[model samples]
Target: MHSYAAVLRTPHALSTFGAALLGRLSYGTVSLSLALSAKNASGSLAVAGTALALFGATSVVLSPVRAALVDRYGPRRALVPMAVVYAALLTVFALVTRDHPGAGTSAVTLGALAVCAGACTPPLGPTMRTLWSQLMPDRRMLQRAYSLDGVAEELLLVAGPLLVGVLVAYAEPAAGVAVSAALVLVGTVALALSPVPFPVRRGSGRRGSARRERTTRTRPRGLMQPVLAAAGVGLCLGGLDLLAIAFTERQHQPGAVAWVLAALSAGSAVGGLTYGAVSWRSAARPRLALICAALGVALAAAGLAPNVYALGAAAAVAGLFVAPALTTAYLIADEAAAPDARTQAGAWVNTALNAGISGGTALVGVLVGTLPLFLCFVLVAVPALVCAAVTLHGENHRKRH
Candidate 1:
């Protein structure tokens, strides 16, 4: 009996680990796939930027709707249809983008395809985390699980681009897109059907979120506080990402771009581990917000560095805050979410972050082609500083509350 029990547990553990890995891989591939597509087809940085920005913007608008469906219909049910549509869109993107002539019409078509693809794939992190929170429920386990989730996110961000770069450099850019779609198909399907963990809320009136929604309705100004703060911070982070992109391209060092971004992500993985390991007894919001603000200022300074080496160093320091800020913001949202709006809160976080990134990219792309690289950094830094100031304000508000 004991041996059989141990054998059963091993498969479950492996399943969970596999699901986590696949989810992160799927999440991380989007950027690499887009970058490869734009670079290969259009051969223009501006076109690449357009693809990335459009994808992010579409995801921002689309993720909330997907989350709502996931909440109501269950992730498994939602994932089945979404995965099929998403894969089909990627197929079209890869095929059409391969031989595309660099023209205004091609750019528009590519951008439209990216948006459709982005909107279709539900935001994986929120859905995965929500499912984890249900499956693991013990506060300690949940904390560790979330940290691992963040680390997986960072890992995917690092690995996905590097892998796609290799595939593109060795075979062809179209190959990278094909591989990404295949992985998304395989991994997303695995995630949906994996029986080790189940949905957090099955839309049951007597059992789940309906009751909680009613109670949360009476709690102050509701979702306004956390949602606004999250969006503001997201805008700052997005600006930083764009600055990095512009800096790399302006330096005439396209190869270095992925490496620098990977370094920053690696730093965040370390930070997520650190945050998850620590056991704080009370709400760590004020302290976390302060830390995140300082991190933002530090990152902005990295942008001002004269050379790539110095910039990478600065980015590393800034990267330290990425996971912490993300984890903290998500934590705040979880605590403050209305019952009916809990899923929406997660979607808002996704949208806010993507919106911030898209906004920053669009704004920076205009100046990047015309200005000095360092100047672009300075421009990007301004928004980061603004974000830090907003976070500081949040800290003060929290103290009063």
Candidate 2:
């Protein structure tokens, strides 16, 4: 296949991709929806914030565990039950918010529901990537598929909040929650039915995801390269979000923060697609380290921008490496794992990225208020440079031994 079109033309590609995006879209919606629903029902920002935090805590922390289920059982068996139960909990949560007024709902009850709902959050993104690994054995084609997947995901996250904003204008925030439930339920069912991940018979002359799952002796140590790289990117992004807002405020153009941040996402989208379109001869592991280093350099330079326009441009430049870094990391992680553990491997990267994002946000929040923005940006970039140096140096050290 010479183009992305050819990659999409592969069997079961469109159906599975569509289903995965639909299910993944729920994640984009649920955050805002849950936050709004909690606030409206509880009428206490503290309660609402606590509920959302608890939800995120369980969802992000338990991601790999859920992915492990997909690996242990099968996507069909593991995903269906998780989606159904997750959807049910979301529906019940919506209803609880709808029925209860301020003080009518106990804080404990809402917090528990949020935690439970998050715990069952299906691992759609990781599963879809695993399906991609199964569908495209050609390294080049798989890269295209991942780039397509990553860009679409970026768009969905942007679109999800806009959708919730529109939805809440017509109805309660709970309506958004209900819609999220429906989306996941329908999407998960379709994905589980897609033609992928069948266990291949021995001597079938084709590799299968399930064929590797039945084995126990698989080295997951190679996972560190991508995981660390992903964490570095996530930390950079998380800190950048806050830094952008601070910059805009200082410039007296607080409204520009939206487009400034949009610039970041735009850069990532273009970078991801362009990365997929290119055919690289280098291995993904080394490519990931280099991209992370490039991202760090871009971000470090961003702090030195003289004005808002320059800052936005620097951010866009930094964004260029963002998607490529993550896409390459995914490729490396996928290659590191046995077929059965592919989902788990991908989930670990996902978890690290999300955790890094959360940590970066918190860490930057503290730093931005006290330190100069320039210093903050430099601090955030350190993670990426260190992670990159560590990975590359380890590889070099191993070569000499």
Candidate number of the best TM-score: 2
Give a tens-digit lDDT track for model 2, residues 281-391: 887766777888899999999999888899899888998999898888899888887776788888999999999999999999999999998999999899999988988
lDDT of each: 0.67, 0.88
**Which residue pairs come into collision in candidate 2?**
none
Scored against the true structure, residue 361 in model 2 reaches a CA lDDT of 95
TM-scores, each model vs. reference: 0.77, 0.94
Q: CA lDDT of 35 in candidate 1? A: 70
lDDT tens per residue, model 1, 1-401: 12212322444544755665775586666677777677678878788888877876677788878877776676578866887788788888888777654533377878888889888875567766666555554555556666666777767776887787777677767667777778777777777776755544444556556675664474334444445445555565666676777677767776776667767777788877777766667564564556556675776577577767777777777777777766766666665664334555667676777676667666776877788766666666565455556656766786799
- RMSD values for the candidates in order, in angstroms, are 5.4, 3.4
